[model samples]
Target chain A: MSASVSPDWIAVDWGTTNLRAFAMQGGTVVDQAQSDQGMGGLTTDGFEPALRALISPWIAAGNLPVIACGMVGSRQGWVEAAYRAVPCTPLDTVLTRAPASGGLAVHVVSGLSQAAPPDVMRGEETQIAGFLQLNPGWDGVICLPGTHTKWAHLSAGEVVSFQTVMTGELFALLGQSSVLRHSLDPDGWHDAAFAEAVGDTMAHPERLAARLFGLRAGQLLQSTDGAIARARLSGLLIGSELAATKAYWLGQNLAILGTGAQARAYRDALALQGAHAIPADTDRATLAGLTAARRLLREAT
Target chain B: MSASVSPDWIAVDWGTTNLRAFAMQGGTVVDQAQSDQGMGGLTTDGFEPALRALISPWIAAGNLPVIACGMVGSRQGWVEAAYRAVPCTPLDTVLTRAPASGGLAVHVVSGLSQAAPPDVMRGEETQIAGFLQLNPGWDGVICLPGTHTKWAHLSAGEVVSFQTVMTGELFALLGQSSVLRHSLDPDGWHDAAFAEAVGDTMAHPERLAARLFGLRAGQLLQSTDGAIARARLSGLLIGSELAATKAYWLGQNLAILGTGAQARAYRDALALQGAHAIPADTDRATLAGLTAARRLLREAT
Candidate 1:
């Protein structure tokens, strides 16, 4: 808690819309801070200054070893950390060193990419690595629900393959921008409505486009509650995603990674289909993954 | 057309973001005008002023009967014209009259609504009516592609049932507002890519949410052209819609009403499936439908 005491290394999770930094002392998070200056907003030159602004107070005499992940390592990030092709371990031993200001020595963790399906992930690879770290040799699927939800097939300490579903993003766009926006209340939810919609869509996923307008139509004709509509919308998308990835989660050892409602919704949706998923903390996964990346760097060197 | 040339009647096509007025002189359009003052922008009081701004010059001492359709008849429009429940004619013999300024008498044509599966259409009903008027005793499906694409089953001069698919809106939202926005060129198109994507999704509609991210991923990994990505996005959504509405168009008398790129895409997609759809013009449908409403008004008087 004391500013005078310096951290051994800093862990950074620089994503599209937010930058999160954690001061790590012997693999434990000593202090954590976040900023709005994420990878999407910053130019190449702006990254170091943005990083310095947040972690400046914790900097000491010796150069602080900063391990970063997510979009910060993307092509548009501070430095391009080429994605490591998957069917390999989530974390690569070799780290991409980045230019940093005085008192900071930065290394970026590479993302994972799949060629056949043409999918790429940055932040989630680190999270997967952390999950694997906590449960060494864990096999099966690790579902990460967020703006761009990723379903990774893990086996024998390697990410076999993964699929990305833009469910969260679709939900946001439809609920905020599309005609459905009028019928959906941002902060409303109905458990029964959600469950029913998930069941319906999973049974007939092709009818999703037809069902979307029903949310608005229902509100207009039957005076359906906005909360119910919102829940149904969420359920419909999640159900469609579930229907698509039936090969990934059906009868597989499943664990959903995240501490957010999106993760919870996914877990609940799967539960409706009689599949139980283990809940994993996102922050813990990110921190543990970053720590694992740092270990990999040390081993490679 | 001169200022002295007054219209026998005015046909109004008012939707969410647009208000179009056609000067109809004995069933022919003498002149046409439009404004951004759509139903979405105007209140009860604002509608008359907005309507007058474009048609004030055409107003004469004799009252001009205005027949209106679309969102202008919605609850939020100038006057609420209650939806005429379907399993009946698309155009009702009765029309709801709205309060208007001197020298202008306005009548709102009722939209069609289905009770079960719950759906509603305002302006499209007019198009369907127009189509029905032109092709009297025609039975089968009428597909109107737009922001809210409609597929209606017509039999015995009545709309047996109808469904609305938000495919167009989804395409717009994903291409313009979602992460796919980065990989899609607004004006780009790839015919082969679109056809392939349509086939892929028609075969696997459940994978839609998953495939959406591929547009961006394909760009990131394979340097896929934005135009190709754009076409693929459109194809994916339309393909999903087609997959859902297989019941409506498979081995049925199909007529597509619209004279836009979207309508053309729908026809092409259907053609890919070996279903030949007769192309119909949207403006003609709307005008014909409004004229039918005017005829009904005259008969009622």
Candidate 2:
């Protein structure tokens, strides 16, 4: 399609397992679209087709400068975006622009990596940038919990360093695939059970691994309540993660970037750990980051 | 086929996932046999044929009494052997015998169940009985670790009560199905890392579920060593199970019933928990249980 006039610019926050796109006019998103056709899905189907399907309507209107973040820039992404080192902020950094096609100026954002232990992230860097953009002049610890949960330290608009957690994914696997599935009531959390487990784990963490076996044993011994066991297991794992992260990024103001159930859970956990948590809208931050990238391109030209 | 002057017996241990059989002459195993036709496998292959295949050799020799235990008594096993309540010892009970063609006596052992929290055990009862027989007057704790690991409290040749742990199966599912697999480095255990994680978990036991996210975070932050992360995860889970068991059965003499690598792992873990563990020969116990069943049959008639 030939470009007649510039349509509203769009920003896409695509990650390994989630794809979300936002329509931006001026500096805010007017409309948004989402699909499960994340980067992980594109590995099976080529990336171009997936992108085309996601934004066909916007593309048909006119060519738009689309800035994307998340897994779309990984080695496994549509195109590999270089990694920015730690202690870098999103505002000063410009996203890498892909070769423009069909009047679409596409920019795939770079993720961040640390060299010491060779840790890396692809899509979260932009989100971190977005988080820093919104919470300017804030220096503290921010946790983004999901399939791969991130605990980041930011100071003076820069992402100093971050840690990742696999809590959600582990819960899913254990719940769905293990024999413990038989014991999980799945109605909701049992507070007493959860609290007891958390208290027990916090007291004697070394027994954490061995204690997992107790779930099945409790059932066999006629001493276990399935719902309680399920909640307890959940508590043990989540509590252990919190303790580890505490050790890594201690004595920092903590902000949690998530929404709904998971965010609430994190809030409760942080409270138990005596850490204050403030919730930041992750989706909005993603859009803002992409919007900033588009504005940067416009100003450059 | 006619009845032989020598008494013939068939022994079967039908577990959830596997079925094993032994042909015996004069209280000695003549030849051993097994099939993948476990209770789990029998979902498709009905009961009669499964039993026939297991004892086909003995069927060819002459009609014999077939004694069985494990899942064969569950709703899914060959036949549901009604559960006998706890406080009952092995020698105090014998399975109900069904007379089959050619004078074969098919005896399906009864499982033990508890009413309070409503837990049950089938095959393990026989193992417990066999263990009791071998030790004669031993008392304390016996742990059988597997997809459904069992921890039993025995007193005066009686299995007082037992608990189960779904440790092995959970490990399999997490290692194979979860995204954690991508981050796992399974070379060997990292002591410092494992100890740190264990310590952290003990301090904040409630966070075990939430802490799982830190596995990914540790990988991303370059703070977690991959190989150690895997072992650490294992430690967290196993350690949790041990902690729970300790709460219920602490101060009891401990004996572990398992073979090969799993047994070794448990031995080490129990040591960490300050529990001295004696390894019980699982395979020998299986054979001993079968032999004891034969003795009981001869004495009955």
Candidate 3:
């Protein structure tokens, strides 16, 4: 298969379960595509073919400079990129050119890792870079909530340290799989119940490990409505995360980076804690980061 | 139905999903029986016949005093016994006699509840009562790890405010239904991997929500052996539980009350945490609780 030379560059945000690609001409995405061919998917089917298939239409149109982030840089991704250890700045971001295939220049981004409890982030580094590009002079905390909610502490354009909370994924698992699932009303948010639970959890956050059982008991005893129980459980989790990250957000400029539905919930939660949650464009940031990396590569050349 | 003359008391531990009865002669259980007449099942079948059938054998011999616990005390149960609020002693335990049923004394135990962020326990109170009887002067925590793991802090004869964790039910649900379950080895526990995961989780306990995706990622990337991944995920949850409850067991004596295969796992986990875990007799404890409640009633009369 031959690669065409139409699009100037390709920006990819590849994560554990999904692959997203944007075709950029003069640093703006002209066309977008996505596939189930995430880093997770490629682990079984192999990397090259999956990447080729996802961007085949763009690739067929033109030979483009490709910048990819996320698990594609993990030991299990298409190719392993060495982790950039933290206190990472824009300059510290590791960039490696991919093997030229069908006349395309592919650059895979390096994942970031911290030594102290040995935490790591793959695609999020790109998001952080994108965040930095938009809010150039801003410095404080950027919280990206998801399965692994990242709380990054930025100082002088550098990511000094960050903490990740497993809030979203835990809620999904508990709500869908556990007995608590029976008690959850997933359709709407019960603010009163949620607030009550969040307040209780904030007061005695340690009790979260214990209070989960109350969902089943409350349902059986009719003391708690299904919707309220679900809300309470969700509140307990979000509250615990809030307690852990309170020191990071207290009296600091806080920005929350999220997409669509999750972002809305996070915004509501941040308000409860009296923190400013400015929604950063997740897609825009990924493209901006890729463009920034591409320009850096071009400038060096 | 006519009541038999001066029948010995029959004890019942009718819970949400199952009903168990004991024919007590003096202080010993001379005959034992069980029925699928769980509160869940009785909700459709009506409570009267279900209760009669469960103890018909013992009833045929003599009209026995039936003492019940668990969901049998709920509005959905045979009768509602009302909730006994927290910081409550055994004397504070609500014991309600069954409504007019021909000289038959059916006393149902009350469920326990906390204040705001209300948590409640029904079957557990009986278990706690049984534990108190067995260890008269003991002062420590009795952990009943199950669908809803209960951690009771006992001082003298009173049950101090205890907490409940939904560990077991969560494990079962995530293992059987969640997306991660697809990547599990399905062959059961892999000890080395499980232990490693437990250790890793203890170190970075907060990553629990995100680390879950790794199961699916590993399966896709082929970086993780499916079997090992499953065990590792299980270990991660167990480890998280251990971390969450560390303070609960740190300086206090720990005794795990469980039975059969699940009990063995709890034993291993307790050992890992350097806590003393004794397999309390589950059947014996239930029987003992019913017997103790009966004696208290007869003595009060």
Candidate 4:
């Protein structure tokens, strides 16, 4: 998309590994920019320069309002933004705003924190907010699949409660770095094996540790193929996640807010358990949520 | 021990990450040798050089038999030794031998394989055999803890059945590489937390996945301690393993054949569930098993 003559504000989704910014004119994204200088890569003071570098061309005359989400608001990010408690409207929640050296007024969307059992999420709050905007007052469960997947219970247009599972990160670690790497197929997936593994783990989640070694043992015994092994590994991990999160999905309208294969896998796994997951693009949801936050700031001013 | 002037044979327990050799004079270990040149670090041809390098000084005039166990007999190792089916005597099970270049009559002990539910073990089989030798006619369960911890059921002086859990490896991966690394205390562990996690997971193993994320969430929420996180990580992994292998431990004389703190941890975890796990040295058991195998071969000859 082409940049508008003068944009309303810059919407930034500053995560751990990637930085994405969208130039917004009124309510639509006019121009987009990205950088690898995520919160993980930058020091305390590097966030502004990274943001400035991305939206330099779009910043023409006056100081532009920048609404950021994700780890950019964490203590490790550019500015330390305190988290908002759950069971509150993410869009309406008090955001942490900080002004950088440049002519930039920045507002960071605070993450949602749970007191019970202790859980927290940053950028996902923005996604949840955007999802809520897309379908106003749609109360159910929105499963946000990522390196750390989040299952949020949405009720009365608020994030009532949510929990996280390190599903994606664990999968990558096991499949890429663990001993089972030799047996698992890196690029293939067997639907049947994945489904069967999911069902097995869901029914008896206690056997997770025992079944994990089966991925390697099966290959040694010549009873399992690479594709099946890979699928089963994924199946078992996700299945265990589902088993822990049965309360969130049972009799609830489930929606998966994620990007690629992992998201599709989540949808498919839930489908097998009689809970069809509605899929949503993470980027779109993030943008919509940021836009809503910007509108709220406008009204507050 | 001292090297015998004229040793009868060499007992070699070669595994994926370690190479241990004990020179046997007559049903006893005389001289000992070891190297980091495990099967994992060598090609097919490198095994001979590695072995010769360690025991060449102790070699006598005749072609001395070298009884080996573990991954050195794996398909990817020195020779593709076939797996011996279980419910048979591990000491009496036929071993595959490769004729090395230096007049060394090499016998590689094949690991035990299970057909039902698909399971296999390489180095641990040797430990099982040795444990049986120490406790003749011991009809109970033997828990061998390591990277791939194994629990074998011995009945009437034979390995009736066994199961493997990636408990050790999983603990290492999560504590070292995963996000939980930041929160978990690398140098310390809390006993109370460990026991609590063990009991919690044993009762409700489904919470393992959720509890895994709790380690990270607790840190982020400032509601968790580093030492407790570390112990809980170990506890959760072991607890899940114990839950799956409950069939082997329930109302059985459980002997944990392993080395170091990990084995002790397993023993303690089992103690919580009313099952007392007797601790045994892994290296001692392996040596005993190799000696017994060499003895059986000599008698057969």
Write one digit per residue (lDDT tens) for candidate 1, span B1-301: 6666668999999999999999898689999999999888887899998998888767745668899999999999888999989898888878888888664689998888999999999988888889988998899999999899999999998899999999989988998888899999999888999999999999999888789898898999999999999999999999999999999999999999988789889999999999999999889889999999899889888
TM-score of chain B alone in model 1: 0.97
Work out the TM-score per prediction.
0.98, 0.80, 0.70, 0.96
Scoring only the A-chain of each prediction against the true A-chain gives TM-scores of 0.97, 0.89, 0.92, 0.96
* Model 1 score (lDDT): 0.91
Best-to-worst TM-score order? 1, 4, 2, 3
Candidate number achieving the greatest lDDT relative to the actual structure = 1
The digit string of per-residue lDDT tens for model 2 on B74-115 reads 765666677787777754346666434556677887877766
Interface RMSD of the candidates, in order: 0.7, 5.3, 4.8, 1.0
Residue A72 Cα positional deviation in candidate 4, in Å, after optimal superposition: 1.7
Task: Please state the error at residue B35 of candidate 4 in Å.
Answer: 2.1
- Assess chain B of each prediction and give its TM-score: 0.97, 0.87, 0.89, 0.95
* Tens digits of lDDT, candidate 3, A1-301: 1234257778888888988888877677677888887776665346767778777787665676788888887766777777777897743434776554567777888877666544567778778888888889789999888777888888888888876676777788788767677777776567888877777766765456667877776775564677777778778888777776776777888888888767776677778877877888888878887787777777877
Per-model CA lDDT versus the true structure: 0.91, 0.70, 0.73, 0.87
Ranking by lDDT: 1, 4, 3, 2
Q: What is the DockQ score of candidate 3, to 2 decimals?
A: 0.25
Write down the DockQ of candidate 4: 0.78
DockQ-wise, the better of 1 and 2 is 1
lDDT of model 1 at position B199: 99
Q: What is the DockQ of candidate 2?
A: 0.32
Q: Which portions of model 4 show Cα errors greater than 4 Å?
A: A1-4, A60-62, B1-6, B60-63
